[model samples]
Target: MRMALFSLVATVMALGASPAIAQEREQVKLVFEHALPNVEGKRMDAVLVSYPPGSKSLPHRHAASAFIYAYVLSGAIRSQVGNDPTQVYHAGEGFYETPGAHHRISENASDTEPASLLAVFVVDSKDGALTIPDKDATPK
Candidate 1:
């Protein structure tokens, strides 16, 4: 009876540890790259964003930030900002986000292959910060 109880406790502890290890592994996958200041007044950070086919970013805003340059390296992306309709960008094309644009939405195209993009954020380091979505865009 005591051995049985200990076995149950050990199984519970192992199950709990699995989720914590999974979360840590997910946190490790995010990486970013930065560039030197150029003629532009903003600092640049580049990130390789990957989305599983048909995945999307939640509607997010950067009200205090100025510009973002998204360059497609592989696969396709559709982007929507503010009240505008979603727009598609193929491999090799680039899209720019304006200052005070307020919202950005992005998604992958296919369901079989992953989409990849190089996102260059030009930010006013003194005041720049990302604003993630707080509410759902589509009405339920």
Candidate 2:
């Protein structure tokens, strides 16, 4: 009986930890990309970020040459860029991040409802990844 009780406690602890692990991850999909004919050596890319309830992305920065505009598509998102205070943006609201800005916060504002955003980036044609994780930084 004691062994069974210990097993039950362990199971409970494992279940409790699952949400935190799940919250540390988000889904990202590249929706569009195109090279600009008028703008020399520049390209435009659009990515969709989806956050499940309680989920968040790790701290990160964009390509040094990228300027980003983010629009909330559904639900609400909480975000903070560089040294700015955190802000919550609802559906139809949007914000921009200048080149080389650090994205300190990106997450769903609601614990029960999922959220999503579309990120439009104008970057140098040679730039690689759109987002780069910060060294020594973790999801909040």
Per-candidate TM-scores read: 0.64, 0.82
lDDT string for model 1 (1-140, tens) is 34633453344334331111111001111134243455355565555566666566666676367577766666787888778888888877888788778556677766655566666566776644544454665422
- Minimal lDDT window, size 10, model 2: 12-21
- Deviation (Å) of 113 in candidate 2: 0.2
User: Can you tell me which runs of candidate 2 are displaced by over 4 Å?
Assistant: 1-23
Residue pairs with colliding backbones in model 1 are none
List clashing residue pairs in candidate 2. Answer: none
Q: State each candidate's clash count.
A: 0, 0
Give me the runs in candidate 1 sitting further than 4 Å from their true place: 1-41, 135-140
lDDT of 2: 0.80
